[model samples]
Target: MSESPISHLKFSTILSKLRAGINASDLHGSLTGYLCAGGKATEDTWGEALALDFTAEGIQDNPAFPQFFRQTRAQLDDVEFGFVPMLPADAAALETRAEALVDWCRGFLGGVGLAGAGKRGNELSADAREIVKDFATIASSNLDVSGKEEDETALVEVIEFVRVGVLLLHSELAPASSPRPATSPTSRSLH
Candidate 1:
């Protein structure tokens, strides 16, 4: 029998689904840090690219800043997923460097059918809202949000929106390489 919608439902389940099969070692603690802080995500191949730290931990300790960054490196030591907003300074810095990218992402995904046109701008739609409520339980399989609040709706929307933007850019900016046979050894390789 097919799985019921309830069986497939995922309200606050972001980490488990998002980080499933993701290696613990591959989850890095920072991106900009990897770029400037002498740190790097685990792995050296495709996995490495995905092992980035989305959480702005540095800004969390301060209050003069507004929230900037969200997301974090999945932890193998524990199991859970939660949202963490970056401080204003960190957010400002990120916004400065990736404002265009962020804007493009917001625009790209805003219309992809995630965010609504009503009161809850960042909140999920009625259909998706239920799924978001159970996000915490779902993400608990691949994340570590021991001390953070369980707020996956906004984070989920933000990430999905950004993903859409990135995907759109890829479709438009990525060079069209010659198609290779599926069975070719190099078929899966990326330049």
Candidate 2:
């Protein structure tokens, strides 16, 4: 599989520079989750995803920013009833990879909540509920990958589970129409 544009943008470094509490994966995941729940992600919405109540700066000036943001939005919009977003996770060390995976899952769940998952949490199907619960568990994973072959394999599988799980949650929660309900939450933006 080819890498995402996000593949090279070190999320940890970005968060550090911005002094952001949320990492890139979680921020993007939140945006993806919010959109899947049928919430619009505008510039203001982006601020909410940042979570510290601070505005995301420099994006409008960065030439690559538009494509990156648009690609994420476009993929999440795909419910071909099949497509999954091509997110980034390419750490060199097993331990780092594990951390990134946990960050991704944690972000995804946070995104879901920001999009009003609780309001309709009870509406989730049996399969969906199981998936959501699984993500919560993965978010707190404490693994010692130490270059063990089995551990490496398990990491791959867990990451795959998250990829598919996000799509499942999006599919299950997405509304049926283009029109937003009168009380639906507004947008939450991301990079």
Candidate 3:
């Protein structure tokens, strides 16, 4: 797979500096899920949905965060299926990457719920619902594994599944011309 447009370590460092209290993988996952659920791609909408303070000092001035945000949105909107979840580099420990995947899944679930997918359950096609369920299972699963070749293979497969599943969800729920509801602060909270 091609390298993710956003580097996990670099983005994490930026978030830490800004005191965002969220990891890069989780934040990217949430952004993907929010878009998949038809949320607007505006910075304000994203910040509100995630309860992040983009107005925080240095947040707006920092070019990296905004660049990452735009790149993520572009990837999802790309016709070439360029979307990829932000995670540790391949050189990182396998266990660390697995844990990041778990975090990503959890963030995705939260994001979808925040975007009102749960309230629109009947609107979701069977495949979308199944994808959500699978994501939930992955979010809750125990991913610990010894550093074996098979474990590496399995992780890669799971990541691919997640990448495709996100694209499918985006196409189904947020078609390019579809009219999406405005996400207000009140509506952004996950119940």
Specify the highest-TM-score model's number: 3
- Model 1 C-alpha lDDT per residue in residues 19-120, reported as the tens digit of each score: 433222112112211221112333222123333342444322332111111122221111221212111222323333233223322222322222122234
Model 2 alpha-carbon miss at residue 170, Å: 0.9
In candidate 1, stretches whose alpha carbon ends up further than 4 angstroms from where it belongs are 1-150, 178-191
**Regarding lDDT, does 1 or 2 come out ahead?**
2
The candidates, ranked best first by TM-score, are: 3, 2, 1
State model 3's lDDT: 0.78
User: Mind giving the per-residue lDDT tens digits that candidate 3 earns over 95-114?
Assistant: 99999999999998888777
Reference-based lDDT, residue 156, model 1: 43
Give lDDT tens digits, candidate 2, residues 67-145.
4456566565554533343334545777877776677777777777877876887898766777778878877767667
| Candidate 3 residue pairs that clash | none
- The lDDT per prediction is 0.25, 0.61, 0.78
The positional error of residue 64 in candidate 3, measured at the CA in angstroms, is 1.8
lDDT of 2 at 49: 52
Query: For model 3, what is the alpha-carbon lDDT of residue 186?
Result: 15
